[model samples]
Target: MMIGTLASAMASFARPGVCKAAAAYHGPPASNFNLGRILRYPNLIGCNRSPTKKSSAQLQLWRALTTLTKREGTVNGPAGTRFSTVADGVIAHNDHAASRIAASVARRQLTCTMGRVNYDVVVVGLGAFGSSVLYHLAKAGLKVLGVERYGPVGHSLGSSHGASRIIRMAYFEGLQYGPLLKRSMRLFLELQDELAAVQGPLSEPLFLRTGMLDVGSVFERALCSAQVQGLQHEVLTGAELNRRFPAYRVPEHWRALYQPDGGVLTPERIVQAHVGLAQRMGAQVLTGTTVAAWRVEGTGADAAVTFKLVPTDATAVAASKRMSYSDATATAVPRNVTAAAAVLTPGPWIGQLVPELRELCVPERQVVGWFEIEAAARSHFAPNRFPVFVLEETSGGAAYYGFPEHGQLPGFKIGLYRHLYEQIRNPGDLDRVNRTANAADEAALRSGVLSYFPTAAGRLLTSSTCFFTNTPDGHFLVERHPRYPQVILCSACSGHGFKMSSGIGQLISRMVREGPKDTAAAAATNTLQPPPPLPPSAPSPSAVDRHVVQGLPQMDSDSDGVDWSELLPFRFSPGDRPGHREALDRFS
Candidate 1:
């Protein structure tokens, strides 16, 4: 990296820089920027810390460019550096400055800074779900607007940054996820066609559906679940498992359940594509804008929860590094702001948004790193030959999952699930989870992987952590926002929800446009919804029953993140009479 680029970067921060205008905004930063710490994302400390050597080298290159520029004084032609390539200062990668420049330029190019008008719908949190919601809303011809705290396609934080995510047909998680997964497959195909036709940035067809294994010492539930759902699958014995994937050295008692129609999904790219489609369809997408609260007015005033907006500044970026946040310089309530339908998908921030979910949503810091492997073994990890795997009891203690080698993330990609840092009080507050691993933690995880793939362990190359928004029951939460019919919330994906994103987005649009006729939309969607408000002193729905919500694993005691208002705008009480007709008219 060059000093010149560094100087330029710092210099650029001057000029009355455009600071982030939101009290709560998010996005990725210079390469390994941990905005998760800023957003108090649940498990940020897990995946987004260290930078790859490649990023270091890039920084050095920038510095060198700056020096050359100074030495040359002024030049019309080659100053040895030009802002044309994808690696130029103008085209920032993980750098906050670059993301800012990119966002700034995009705003100008797309006329993004125009005055905001009203719309029918406003979407926030553009990860997997928000982006898709925007696309469908736009396609359905609704005046829609979207606000993403991160830069275009996401600021490079959260569980969505990775190259590939596994997609499967026979979900072991349960049949509840089967329909959505299947629909997502269809949407992905549709996306491929739509993107190819647009003839712009090309996103090719997704990886082939080779298959996947849910190899666990004590569980065959995934296999059974698939069978019960009538999905095609196979339970391979010791020899069969080894034969299908020789690299896997399964123990005698251990076996593998293979879902042949399963494969990989381009996770990060999926976010970009959906949002891109939405924007192209005329949905106003404001990157680097946070959803500061809003005012839900009207007879549908139930949509009263207002979302505030904010932009990024230099100090804002620096403070975010320390995992802190500043207030927004400016704020606006979108014209289409949904008083009701808010999808709270703050990946690791489950603790922040719905602290009650703390019990259900354990904020475990997890990591994923690439291991360099030989060519022969590459096939064993290839998208076609190598089935995406979630090996639970690999003679190696590591209960991890892996995808085919893609991009620079080396080796047959592997990551340990149990090796993750345990639950913390909060993901953002530094004092919470133990980002630093103790000897026991390392040994536990290391021993786990080492035990199973003895040779593979030796090849381990890189590692990074990610948070899981888990549901105690290991399902997902795609329900209406408590106390409000217009607001909907989506969260708790357990460990795997990236694959069904296309379908999830579709359902969001379907529900917004078609109302409750969107039954398949609900099944295809997963989340929790709170009942409408009752008279004061009324017990919470769970309180009236004297029993906790069932199927949930466990919950935290000090969960202040859940919206704890005395009365919901229009909560959904179990015994409450049907108010769907009125609600539909308002939303429609």
Candidate 2:
């Protein structure tokens, strides 16, 4: 009920940014849970009401409240703690938590802070791009720091915590992703060596070079990957597909395009590896630390940009609070970088952090739920036994993918990536049940499973839900942070970015290292030329917002733009083609 009163107070503010301190005031229906806020002028925002050291969520809520309220007063919650404000003192300023929450909630502009001392090169995120870049840069002898508020690896918040991720060289997403995927698998092997966790989550091996299917509208042109790149693959008849894998009862109209190199990617373990490697290489990988704000400077090295971080030590390797990094460190150095890159791999947090990607980053409440099929039945879905599959036009008008059991998460977990949708605007608001597969969703999948492996679906047992970050064309966005030049961005996995993280990390790292320093003459004069052409398949993520929109960290450690598109399994019909019908009928 206090949330209602809190809303009214916030509504009174003129501009959300103007914040100030309000005298301690109490409201009706007081309780421990409700806290009063104090708003500062010009910046129409209020401070956290926590009487204790402000918790992160409280700080975020306070920032949201700031956008709406200016009158400082405490409203008691169920617990009955004094709904007092946090900016109760001159030294205690509005924290980074407030700024990030405001930025994410408003999705327009905000500020942030991280530590007492700012850093030279700060990796704002630790997912696929950030961690990889940190590791490579550190190894290259760069002083680097990698901070992640969610802790080592990921804390089950985004696209990084899933059990298994699919990996393949044949890309249908776009030509840009092909080289990236191929390089990813190789670096994954290298990363495995670095972590030395053989058999553990990070060390677990995945099925590779096993073909995958592209079952959507883009299958035709997507196949350019297979044709031009010569990646081993073929078009199979629905009957042949059924015979090849007795588990799938391919629908008459469904089509199957296979690329022999496709396989699975494990989420948690891989992140562990990337983080571990980055840390070992001397990059400080901090979990539970979040960037609160960023400043763009017109002059100086460290002054060009500044990021504030909040120490959520609970998740960090060591509990410490705050870290700061600035590019325009001195007023003499004019801003050299055009934009700073924010590798926004918040997984599910994509909905909140960047609302523009909201439509494309549809947050599907997918259950990583699995069946209790017999171990023998696992062969049907196993990476070696089965090429990771994508089913469209199935008997039930649905689509989904299946992965082999990696020892833990149980019998082949498979669900459509298009199940539930829960819109989130605040990162602090993420602690509830997201969308999950309902009985109908399970039933549809069960029917499809039964049609493929009649007995497998019947062996079902427990099931649960998780989430995925999606995009319209299922490709990734790797570009400069649109508004700020010093910021580069990498996000919108759309469900298939895990396997490529290794390669992606290297590319992002190279971009950071290159940081506008690459001269073409340096390459030609140095004779640092070429590798043989790699295998290819479909177009991987050609969703060119084409408007100079940002994309995955744009280069490999070698500074070469990793050609990622060649890795996609298939491309769509570009305008028209004769093989279209034949192609459509093959998987059907």
Candidate 3:
């Protein structure tokens, strides 16, 4: 009987202008209609269009009814007759039932419109490097998404959370970094100005120019790099350094190099700024979510990288509360997102994500501490008075770096490079180990402070632990993955990467925009040759011009013809150790 009534109503509504208004539907309320059972009939739900041609209005009504039926799941009503025909070209149902069906139709339409999950590029980490990539990609008008494991952009869980980091033009590692440093400094300043224009002025500046002082064995290298790069600097004995900055008490025998361009950068602030500005520029960011697995699908131009996103424990709990899911398992379901390309900058977690480079990238534990300054010595340790310094106790001995008291922090910041020499084979071990500063770590930092800045080592105010994603050669790995060219592997900065993150971001963005280079020939030959050098008369901008340029040019064109592939190659050979100079031939 119910089937007969529904059939009759469908036939009547199919006629032109038969049921134009609710008043026309004056038959008995079809409140007890069995949608679950009716769905089995092909003709009633307009699924079998081949049987007969149906009116546009009839098709619309039937489609809405089918959508409502599937979404609400067996909407139960009376089993007996409920729908009835009252007169010619008229049908009727309860007003409440009519409104419920309309609501369901609206919801189904909304769901259909809001289900797009495709992007041009997806950055798989929101650390210093990843955030910058996201911002640059978004600024270039690409649809980009940034995924972060931690809840906040600048959370302390990763390597980018230190309050302050050193930024200097005179790189002691190699002269190859000169071009990158110059470009990065320009970008950092431009970012500051851009943020000020959009979000008003920041309370704290992103880069602070306090200059940098390098002492001991590193002095000669720094001085040479500074001279070659045409940077303004001063060469002084330990006594001259003490005379210029009263806070230090260096041994008179040690030589020191001071470059006026070096300064301190607020790491947390830079990360946050990049993320916030990226979001404002239409970049999507997913925090408290992690990528469980990812792969490249298809080949050539049709290739796409898909990532499976799983919420962390904290994210799952928050989502459950907001959604009111009865079963916790429902909220834990993983979602997949597809992108044309992906940039992997997961920091220490890079090894876990890409097992191919596990041995190449290792995470080492590090500790940093802040020591209170004496009341009378506070003036000398101020940011304006004292410069950031790196001291080597003996030639090629353990080196220590420190920053003058600045920001809200209560003491002068100091840390030992590769502190404790504790290596973490498994990235997950970081979570299990104690993160608090230990007594032994504090004692080591205090000893360095006593040897150098004795006046600032009054008391231990606070301390924290962080990790360095180290490469075997103490350089960085900035290249596409060996197996998947669509996926770029950018990790293992060996502790001094944060400063060059801006330039790195620009490099990755250009790679994504131009599509992956065709290195198949090189792979086929199994011989990767270094890029050729620029002509002697090539017009290269000076360091000063690079720093103040209005429009930052591409790294290839503006970076003094430095080939990044030679500086940081992607090839990984186990047990094959290449000297730093071999990798960076420009410096040699």
Candidate 4:
């Protein structure tokens, strides 16, 4: 009797024009329905039984769940009644009639419980990109929640915990990023002023305008991009760099590109500022908690994503135990949450949760160290006196970068972009101390230090180990998952993403608001809609174009860099590959 009634109801709702929108949905289907809509559908229950009867509602809901399962390519059960499909590909059969009734009751209870905790978007990972997304989404009036693994900002486990990261407009990565870089610089400056207003005058500013210089083969591409973008930059020979800076001994055969607009952005303060501002704008941020699992529950506006939380370590929980935040309207918030959409920017740990990208988003251990400079020469390492520099050595073929001494840090900070990277099998078991700068690590950096700024190699003041979530090609992975359209993948920074994270956050905000661009013309029509089908394993080349930019110009036709037409994300050159460089190339 229940199967017969459900068959009639499906036919009635399947009419050509009646469910055209529902038929257009290509993504996975949720085994859920709007209760009011189910009640209103004609003949949902035979005229023999009252429409409001509990038995009739249960049968109707059971039929709806079976229909959704079929649409989602799930296996059907005996008597055509099943609650939902499990992850292990097993068709949980319903045998007894009483068992079906119990399943319906449990599902109803779950729906009610899930409806209480709701948000438009939930961001996992509160590092550089995640925090920025939280701020932008909340500012746009979307109910947002941010989750981080560590308790306090000072824990410093991930990639965004360093004293400072360099930000420059003349990008050697690609000319296509030139516009976004320009926009990021503007936003970075604006963020500094915004943070000061709410948090009071910071003893140390967020961004310091220290000019930047790039020396090596990378300089040609960077200079060319600078010229094309009409940016302010000067091309100098090795002698000029050495003569002007005085702290460096440059090989006369090499060249350099100098841009004055470049500077350093403090990572710790940036994360804190973004979180504080986002919370004030009505976003809820939970730290020291892990998102164990999540599942999609419905479709479209009625769609809901529920996440399960796992208890963290004693240290992290204790640290965050007293750290509570009031909502924008001053209401206290609980620790758990649910949302319509979720953004996963978990950094190196993303692989553990997203099994598909495990091979692609490999976590590699990296070390960053600070070295004290002679007191008499400390003034030269200041932002105004010395510019941030990237050197590609022609001798040893290694590229190293450093930031001038700033604020409370007692020494200049430097590190090989990817020279000493050690692959980490699991991010959870990361060694924070990273072996305390062993002899090999110290010796490699010592050579570069003595060769470049001989006066600053006083002593190793401090060092810390961090993980770089590297993609196969060393480009960023910023798009919605192919299997789960509701889940956004924003990991694989590849060690160079923090500089443009502000811009990346803005781009992600639009993606969450407008959906994917190819299938849904949300940007052109100003309407938020679901995106179309994604390609297998990854998005098509045009996917980045549709969302990241309208049309990207090609990079050098025959250069060692990736083909711009392909728009491969998280792209780095063979020499630029983390910890791998040509033996002959010195200052890369």
Top candidate, metric TM-score: 3
Q: What is the full ranking by TM-score, best candidate first? A: 3, 4, 1, 2
Query: Once model 3 is optimally superposed onto the true structure by TM-score, how far is the C-alpha of residue 119 displaced, in angstroms?
Result: 1.0
Candidate 3, residues 455-526: lDDT per residue as tens digits?
Answer: 988888987677798887788887776667878878888999999898788777766754556343444553
Q: Using Cα atoms with residue i matched to residue i, what is each candidate's TM-score against the true structure?
A: 0.61, 0.60, 0.70, 0.67
Better of 1 and 3 by TM-score: 3
Per-residue accuracy of model 1 over 18-50 as CA lDDT, tens digit each: 222211224322231222121122222212332
lDDT, model 4: 0.62
Candidate 1 C-alpha error for residue 176, in Å: 2.1
Task: Please give the lDDT score at residue 253 for candidate 1.
Answer: 67
Between prediction 2 and prediction 3, the one with superior lDDT is 3
Full candidate order by lDDT, most accurate first: 3, 4, 1, 2
Error of 3 at 161 (Å): 0.9
Compared with the true structure, all predictions reach lDDT values of 0.50, 0.48, 0.67, 0.62
lDDT of 2 by residue, 1-588 (tens): 334433332233223222322323321111111122232232222343333544344345455555434332222323222211121111112333333222222321111221122233566666655666666655543335565655445445445655566665546655556555556666666666556653366444532334577654435544665554446567777777777866666664556777766666655666656655545444455556555555565432222355555654343334221222111211221112112233444565554554554554455555656776765666666656667776655333466677655456567667665654444435455545443456775775676566555546655555655555555456665544445434455665666777767666666555554443322344335321223344554443221212111233443222344432332222223234223343234323
Positional deviation of residue 100's Cα in model 4 after best superposition, in angstroms: 46
RMSD to true structure for each model, in Å:
21.0, 19.3, 16.2, 14.4
- Give the Å shift of residue 319 in candidate 2: 18
Most lDDT-accurate candidate = 3
The alpha-carbon root-mean-square deviation between model 4 and the true structure, to one decimal in Å, is 14.4
